[model samples]
Target: MGGGWIFAVIVVGLIVAALWAFTKGTPTGRQAGSGSGSSDEVAQLRKNLRVKALGNDALVNRLVQAERNRMPGASEAACYKAAIESWERDNR
Candidate 1:
């Protein structure tokens, strides 16, 4: 009976520890975009786009313009491409 109690306590402790580790160490932010690409690569791509266009405000405005110009049900990729094009046009 004592051994059983010891085992139960150990199991509970382990469960608590596992739960704490899982929750405490996990990232709490927007997930990275899907694909085989590393997060660093995706972040770098976003950074490059911003740098190429000057800043986030410009990028966002361009995205809004692209959304307005897009057909209904346009893919995100299409919108992003349009935003890049608009940014290039305006910045140039």
Candidate 2:
């Protein structure tokens, strides 16, 4: 009976570990080292827009559009500016 209990515990532990591993597989899509449109840039823009938006959906949509229109090889600063412009345009 004790041996059976141990086996059950081991099986449960293995199942839990497997589930954790599966759920933890890989992170977000953005890669920091991917260059040209790094995660940092995207993250920074998100942060800035979040702050500017102050929980407004309209501003959020503008931010999304800005990010969607982001060009390759564009710097984070440029992206930020563009996003801001989009937000401002829509805001007013």
Measured by lDDT, the strongest candidate is: 2
Looking at model 2, residue 42 earns an lDDT score of: 63
What is candidate 1's lDDT per residue for 1-92, written digit by digit as tens?
A: 89999999999999999877643332321134534335563354345456655687665656645665774565444444445556566776
Q: Which lDDT values do the candidates have, in the order given? A: 0.54, 0.61
TM-score of 1: 0.36
Instruction: Report the lDDT tens digits of candidate 2 across residue range 1-92.
Output: 89999999999999999887643332322224545565665665566567667867576666666665766556664565567656666677
Candidate 1, residue 56: lDDT:
72
State TM-scores per candidate.
0.36, 0.36
- Cα error, candidate 1, residue 24 (Å): 40
Which 10 residues in a row give candidate 2 its minimum summed lDDT?
23-32
**What is the Cα-based TM-score of model 2?**
0.36
Give the poorly placed runs of model 1, Cα more than 4 Å off: 1-45, 61-65
